[model samples]
Target: MLPNYLCYVNSVLVYRSGGTNRLTGLMLAAGTLALLLVGPSVIQYLPVMVVAALIFVLGIDLAKEALWDTIGRVSREEYITIVIIVFVMTGWDFVVGILAGIVFACLFFVLQASRGRNTIRAIFDGSIARSTVRRHITQRRFLEQVGTQTQILKLQGFLFFGTINSVEDLIRRALDIAAWQRNPIRFMIVDFSLVSGLDFSAAEAFTRLQRLLEAKDVVLVFCGLQPDSAVGIALRSVDLWADNGVRLEVFANLNEALEWSENEYLRGMYASGWASARAFGRAMTGAGESGIEAARTFSGASGSDMGAHKPSTGSGAIPGLEAAGLDIPDSKGRQPAFVLDSGFENSPRRSHLQQAVRMALERTGGDAMMVGALNSVPEIEPENASSSASDAEAGLEGSERERTERRTASSGEQLPPNALPQPGDGQHQSHNQTAIQQRKRKLVQPAPLLTLTFKAYAQEDLGQEFFANLAPYFTKVRISKGQKLWERGDESDGLYLIEKGILKARYDFPQEEFEINEAMLAGTIAGELSFLSGQVRNTAVHAELDCVLWKLDGTNLDRMQMERPARDFSTFFRMLLRVTEEEQECLMSYLVTRLS
Candidate 1:
């Protein structure tokens, strides 16, 4: 025992100390010496079971503490991870099991991230208040049509191969629906704001979608993308589907992406002359802008350029066909006959005749003057006769001026100085009496401004008289079926009163379908959403049939405020407010009924 103590101190603790261990060694040596000298019968009295029982109880306490009660609170994937570690450690090698658990958790995490959620939240118009870009009225109408044709897919969660299928399916379905509705899509916007990460596989899906859309002549746009986001990095790493003649645009937000898409669509239409869209672009798309630039670029180099001058030639000479350029020697020419022979019997060929006629018209002076059947040039005989005719024309002109002056003075209620007659003349007395009677009639009864359906929507104090007075300020518009009157997100510039025909109010949803909100019949007031709330339009109104509507915009309101008396204008304004409230109530009730 004393030797064992010395070995333990030297090999284990490794410190030069001779305190309790040395004393214990001395005691054990003495005890062993005494036992050898006296007796060894007392060694069998120790209780080994009690010590084993105590060890077992301590192990039970540690096991109970290790089995945490909150295991169920974790995710199933985490539970699987825990189970793997525990099972392997209990049944196999501890280090190997730990390594296996780490690998399993990493794999599971990757799988979970790849299966993230992606969805669409909303779809709206580019004309919305925040997306204000200048456009012509026709261009705006086209944009409204584009709003119906554009599909916006607002995505949520991570983007990977597993989620890309669902996203692509949504787009495909939307496309199919558009085609079925006879309104094929022109643009598709994918908003990836909720995406947390991205990989090459998902980027490939976007490329595939772009190819499919391009085949249908549709442009694809990516929006709500973070610059350094995982998806952004993956997309950038792959050169972002920029190859293979397929083009796409990426934007930081939805509104910007929509604006860019609209601009691109407008330019494409202008360049291609599709649907004769160049007329709208020419007026709305300003000089040096996208629409005009596209037109100029595609219109070809033969067109006139800013500083390029046309080749000059003598009045009767054809430009670029001068004698020197034609290389015909003057010595051999008898001033060539200029006869254009067409191989036609009796009459020249159509094109040849047109060319000969054009050349004759281009000749200077009266050498080749051609006149139509209805137009004749009368010949003047001699100089004296022409002078006599000129004198007669001067006399007629003087009489016409005198009549015009008389009419002007009569309208102004002031007799011209030269037209004044002597006092008490019978003719003068009669003229004065007639003028006074006419002025009296005009002052007593003014003509009506404009005729409208004055019988509709009138209430207390707001009757035929009210509408008659208001009718002059409103403008009338007629829209055909399937034509959009105004779109959601259009400026709150006016209110409308449907005079005839039916109108449908619709809203675009995230699901890429329009929900018909209500049917607006004659007498129904539209645009109350803007008129009352002072916000942009939240719904679009389209003509269900040929509709006649009376429009009242701010210009009309300004005119009312200016031309009408203050008391009358204020009263009319208040009545309009009341009408707006009633219209809103009607709309709300319609919605409630439809929803219920």
Candidate 2:
């Protein structure tokens, strides 16, 4: 019968369990089988130890997720429970740790119940307050609550001096902040209110607080100190240190205590510096204030000597900007700073960091930031506002100074989207920035240096399907400034059909007329030698404005050669090369006719 039941359970587990749990269950079952076959000695040292080690690793993971403060102050009773279990299960009988920990936890709860006390809540002023006053506990009850409003702490079992630490820290913080504190209480409504209790140490601690508050003119109010109890009325008689200041009040009715608390609260608020601004009487009595003095009094600091405006580009060096921030613009010291505003803390940093991440993800095609699983942290922009404007003449790219002055009053002009340049050492930085701008110009026309017009004719008659098949074999590549696509005198094996961007192909020579002759843009083709023969490259290819062009290799031609229309275009290669020439001429025309 038991064997049948076991089989049924095994079928359920096998169907429902997944990888991790199945592995764990298999380990446990194998360990149990080993114990049965090999006896406890050998099995305990091997499989049991391995399983226990894995379980311990799981515990470590749980501990990492727990809050630091809670872990720091684990109760002494809980510590003893863990320590005792560990001691019992260190060697031979290892499973005893888990069993002992569970048993001790249950025992701790039992201990709490054996020493518990209950205090009743008293109602007054349409709200229930924490206090002690007259109540019915079999023919005798005094005021259920008393004194100005405060916290109620109910004690059970023996009172020790250690409890003092808890009371003092709780009270001080409560005075400044309107939150329920867990330590030194300002005004405590210790509900010995129903504590038919007495301990010299606990009684003395309460006395000390009352006196300490008196010396500092701080108040300590107590509730439910019964007149007839052994330690009750006597505690009311003893002086706290010396000043017989506001004597702790004992009440007979809950309502009376509530009425008294409301009056006291109002008086305390009036004593503080804040009164309603519209209170005419206080204003007439010279209690009102205005202007800088009033602002200073509220903030509580004097003579800071800070004049108004923020430091500017003219104010010399301010730190904390890096490529980590925006690239500071190439017009540095020549342009106004890019000021970013944000709706979050460290506004400038929040905006810069957010923009930096967006630029990185876009620049790298998302693969750079997204690995197999976790998203990588993008580069962080530096946190401070940086100003790097150079001298007045630096703005000579035009009268940029005049434009800046005209826009000075307007806080709205922001850094262009093109401002987040790719970052690295000086080497790739310029190239990456230029490449991005060049591609953007092709797509959105943000800027354009050249344009090309093209018309294609078949070198031989062919069909449309042939040309369509060959079209896909072409791919575009973008290169930034100083990127050596090919070196001079080296073999250029593959073909480049320029679709956009400035690729200036020049033979290295010094001349008075022009340093470069061919400025390739849309519909230009180059690099046919090494690409066909698979030989060494020739002619260095440097991107003028981050160029993009198509790569048409031998495989591309081979695939399209069978297509009728593609086969018809015997001079198709030369037409693509013509496009490169037109682009280069356009750039040269711009340089000589306009700028020159």
Candidate 3:
């Protein structure tokens, strides 16, 4: 017979635990040799041996990660029970050990099947290095903001007879805990949202879990259950959950389920939906594989310009699979699919590309007020603007003209545009009379960048008037890996920010050059001197990785003349400042200690 258990254990352990779970392979290899010498009896019992090894190894791993204090907090019976199960599985015949542990396994199934799959799907709040989101949002088209919680989790699959033993052990062990008693679970909702099919074994396992839960005063509910499918048929027409048993209301709509579940009576209830197609999609359908395995087939907007703010959305299109977050046409390119990105080498958005373009364009003619070229944006509330103008007219039409005349005569001189207006100069007041003209501030839809910090920043701080006007003037520039933003002595025309990919800023010394290493993470500011001075770039920016940056035109000399809020631009600056300050402080502390 094929070694079913060994096959899966070897395959799964390698993928899930990587090198940490490699013991199974070694055990299996040794077991093969043992069988050659010991004969069939030992070999017949091999499955249990592998399982035992698995439990001990897994437990050891868990212990390594566990807070030992919690071990004492649990009761002895559960611990002994766990130990027995592990011994039986690891020490005896694989088939018999598994068979002997059936009681514990049964208990496990009863508990797990009762709860089904109430999952935890959250957009991890922090950097990829610190969080799991980066692992899941690997595809180039999976437009996820570093911190945006737009990513979702729809739990799929089901628990059946095969996993029943695990279910029982989990239930029994959980009940044995002091915490469970102190904070008793009253209700649990199993989301069957994505359960397309169910088998009898799983059905049997579910019943056991439900019964065990109810015994502990915990009620079970099911959601998103499609009645015609196997799980549906098993649940709707079976034992522990028949019409006579506790009937789980299957919801086709989510809002209805939410509405019912929100009742005060259901306050202590914990229920996670079981997504069927949608749930499977979370694992299978998205733009990319999200680094986590089990989700293999993924899709993305590969081989296309993503963040290049083209009024024509066509430029944002990807050649194969379109990205998840862009506003590209819905029907073009590949259908919504899931692709896995193991390394975060490829960014989900083209923000870096766009940034690089804007930076290059800035040299041509840059704006300081706006981070990117500002397209004329009509006000959202035109009527509100008109009303405000009308209010100004009313304020001006009445005593203001006479007041201006009196002030003009008293001042006795014509005021220049550069002069700060007093109460009024008759002529200076005349310009206000023609109407304080309102410039339709260009509205540019900045491509929003999601950082690992969960903070989102858009393209170019368009809030500043200088950059606002400069945004429209911005153009596209491309650079390969290790290329500098500008060479030393090249007229300092503009500055660059990492829009999508990685970039670095280096200062050239007499013999060599040095660059800020980690401090120059994405969202960093580079070439500020070039934009500020009408001279050549003092520092050279080299792309450590293939990068894209927003370039502010060097020629837009008037853009940086004054500091304005630049509205939305402040947020990006704040992010850069935060990263820079933290790094600078570390350096300063080192310098102080060295000097002392």
Candidate 4:
């Protein structure tokens, strides 16, 4: 056995002289067979000195290549290993030395592979590395505010028992900080896109991580796992991809995983914000049982019911308020003269009204504009009440009459029957009839202009002047729920301004499945990229709910440039540019996060 091992080693060394080619190995085997067949007869004629000199030369050459040539080329540890193996072969046995070398090679490889610190490439939160899905400005701001709640750890290189501990320690420290801050981490995303492989021990470490995250009520999300890949198989073997509700989620890519986490964050925020808003409304109303009802009514009307009413046309009235049973007048009309009626004196409801007003002012972030409205509430006098009523009755406009009625309703007063248009009075009856018909017409007519006072537009400091000038360029387009607005690669025709409802933009590629890239909310601009640049659409847009949009096509834009003042056209163009800039920045951020 010893002789056979030596023979095998000699053949390998001879093969090395031929640059390790298969043909050279074959020739060496044939030569060795021939030499063995005739060895006894040939050896007697050969000079023993010649054999010794050839062996000496071979040893010298091998030593020069292994020991001398490797001095500065290999690591110090590896160089030392080579020296130890050579010393063992010289002092002890060659077989023992070869075994020791194998052991050392493995030990060093394990030590180098298990350096876990480099395994985690980076850590990010929602603020810096957001999902590809674009949301409304307000929703984006909210995500930024609570970005720390979602932690992402991007991992790379080989993962084993030694390296996984570092990842676990990092997550534990993050969890500890979150607990201390009273904002526990909601989702911990472990991205394995760059990971080359992971061992069973590393898989078990992830299992332990899962248990810890579950105990802390945090979700464990895994992304970038190919189903047939070794890492994925190892993780799956540990039941990490089990159908556990809320505890674990797996996605194909980081973007999908991020989008899922973000959606969860937003959903929670919406629920909590609604609860807070309801509580605020109840406190303001100051009617224990009725306060709850009022809160519910206010929240529902302001939120989901906003789209129920038709948009106002030049009325400046909040469309849904009347439907919500709040009898407020149009903005163009005069303010209701709130006279101090007999019923209002020393009324308990007055204090509640004051509290409501004060609370509203506070909620508005204590804007100075509302301070005057708060102070003047108690100073309402009845001195000019009779004159105002008389004026309202004597052919005052229909909107004025409506305002008076709303004011009287709040004051718990009723107008005398004679105060209403008398049946026998021809002029008053005709005028009253005309007013009623006009009110009906306003309700049925489609609003000719977008309301600049909408929170989204108001944020841009747009006012009536901007609305009046730009509104004419937009044509209203209504889309039903589930209707597709445009498909990917479609020619860019125009940009859309969302007046009401939600639209979602989805990206689809031949290599990947479709994913929703953005949610276009009311008052946001959509398709601006393709519209402005004249490029083919990259995403398909569809209505998430019944939608009302104002579309501005190239034709109208060209007309506006020709007919409108340069300032107006420039202002509108700047707004489009700003929207494009914001979208680009968001896209760039997502791409950077993904690549990094």
Q: Best candidate, lDDT-wise?
A: 4
Error of 2 at 130 (Å): 8.3
- Which has the higher lDDT value, candidate number 2 or candidate number 3? 3
Q: Each model's C-alpha lDDT?
A: 0.49, 0.38, 0.38, 0.59
Clashing pairs in 1: none
Score candidate 4 by lDDT.
Answer: 0.59
Candidate 2, residues 497-551, lDDT tens digits: the string is 5434445555454555433333343333466545655676544667665555557
TM-score for candidate 1: 0.39
Per-residue lDDT over 1-596 for candidate 1, one digit per residue giving the tens place of the 0 to 100 score: 11112333333222223334667667668878998987767666757786456545544443443345436677778777877776676677778777989999988877765554424344443322113222222333444444545666667666666667777776777668445355445667777766677668888888778778876656687776765877777777767644544567667765456555554443333333222222232222222222122223223222122112122222322221221111112212212112222332232222322332233222211111110100111222365544534443343334335565778777887665656543345655565455433322211101011111211122333332444466667776879978998888988888776644567777667767425345554434577558646798888878766776668788888898899889777776665565565455534432342232
The lDDT, on a scale of 0 to 1, for candidate 3 is: 0.38
Q: What are the candidates' C-alpha RMSDs?
A: 23.2, 33.7, 22.3, 13.6
Report how far off residue 326 is in candidate 1 (Å): 48
lDDT of model 1 at residue 206? 80
**Which runs in model 2 stand beyond 4 Å of their true positions?**
1-158, 162-164, 175-188, 233-246, 252-255, 266-596
Of the two candidates 3 and 4, the one with more favorable lDDT, higher being better, is: 4
Cα lDDT, model 1, residue 473? 72
Count of clashes in candidate 2 = 43
Of 1 and 3, the candidate ranking higher by TM-score:
1
For model 1, the superposed segments whose C-alpha errors exceed 4 Å read 1-72, 118-146, 156-158, 175-184, 192-197, 224-233, 241-244, 263-563, 566-568, 571-596
Clashing pairs in 4: none
Off by over 4 Å in 3: 1-162, 168-225, 238-455, 458-462, 470-596
Q: Give the alpha carbon lDDT tens digit for every residue of 311-410 in model 3.
A: 2233323321111112112213312111112332243222332232333223322211111101111122445666644543444444345565577779
